[model samples]
Target: MGNGYLRFAALGDSTTVGLGDPLPGGGWRGWARLLVESLQASYDVSFCNVALSGATAAVVREQQLDQALAHRPDLASLLVGVNDTLRSTWDPDRLHADLDHVAGALVDGGATLLTVRWHDHAALLGLPRVLVRPMAERITRVNEVYDDLHATYGGLRLDLALMPEVTDRTCWSIDRFHPSELGHRALARAWAERLCAAGLDFPLPSLEAGGGREPSWRRDVAWMVTEGAPWFGRRARDLGPWAVRRALAAAR
Candidate 1:
């Protein structure tokens, strides 16, 4: 049915990069890979994951969009903007414009565009109390942009807020940012369900969470000390003052 060969290209940030779901031999085998495997039973699926770590929406447009489009994919998933919300330079209009351009191109090129409405990541991260409201507002605006894009282009949009497992600690990796192996499998299963409902003739991916390394408390602490702390420090430098200013303005 259809083309018999499905070209699926993933464009976004680290989550799409599969950071939380590492392969045994190395590298990441995220939701995109799992979804592709499910499609294998019904069609020849060609997958390209061009998502980068810490990529903003603008970054995706400028960098990854061309790479994804070059593959001439029949299915495209754009799951970015959380990085944008974290930065002081976040601009919803610009986010909308960048996403619009990417979504428009995908739709016009005959690809089934996929988007995401992110959840309350700030709450989950337990960011500083000062930043909670502002970050939530930013995520809301970002979701609004996705809403506009979905209204215009008409595609599958996954809303992470509805996923009960999103708030579960087990669903998150050590970084507490990216999804764990179980989380990635859940996401892949969700996508498979959506695709099947949309008439994709593919077997559903197994919901069983296996094949990834188990989490270790020692590894978690090590990563937090090495990777997480530095990342938080960098973001605090930028987002801290911004949050303070927003708070002050709100008080006024």
Candidate 2:
């Protein structure tokens, strides 16, 4: 799509790029891509994915935001701040400014904002002591800022948190960081529901439409008891191409 052709332009990190579980394009197919297609079909719209790998909120603003702005989308979605916590790089001031820039730019382009937060679903239940505290803190801080920012920016909608089960467990396969095919679908569905609530109102690209029933991810997550899995000890990094590619293919 050309500049302005896309009604939505998504920004942020791996989640933005769909680094959940690689499908076919060296990138994964997750909620971000699903949201784009669903919005297009449900609203008769188009979108651009300007998501990059390893994007922190600061980097996203300084780098990707301008490129996304060039699309002049009718809507903009962002799920940043994960990396900030991962790298211990949280900066409330810069985050606020960049967030304003993103929202303001979207408004100028006649689009709305879709604000989101991502915390590893695994940070609940029996998560290790070290991991739980920091992760919880990050989620709290990020959500707080996100809520405040969206409140100030009228057309913005605060989407829900990540899929608890899929994220919290080893649903991703061996690496256990990004979402697996199943995990990606769960994420996509959750996102679709939020958009539907925001008035997608129809089922063109929604899971409620012709798409297969609740991809395995959502189903598996729903039933998981968190009783039989290894806990996350270290922070996560990016994934390999095979994984990313698998995710993209699934999305297509």
Q: Which candidate is the best by TM-score?
A: 1
Distance from true location, Cα of 198 in model 1, Å: 0.6
Candidate 1 structure quality by residue, lDDT tens digits, 72-100: 98899999999999988888899999999
- Worst 10-residue lDDT window, candidate 1: 207-216
Cα RMSD for candidate 2?
10.9
What is the Å distance of residue 133 in model 1 from its true position? 0.5
- Which residue pairs show backbone clashes in model 1? none
RMSD of each: 1.3, 10.9
Q: Which regions of candidate 1 are displaced past 4 Å?
A: none
Angstrom error at residue 27, model 2: 3.4
- Which parts of model 2 have CA positions greater than 4 angstroms off? 1-6, 40-44, 120-128, 156-174, 204-252
lDDT (CA) per prediction: 0.89, 0.59
Q: What are the per-residue Cα lDDT tens digits for candidate 2 across 143-190?
A: 777877677776545344534545445445334555555555566666
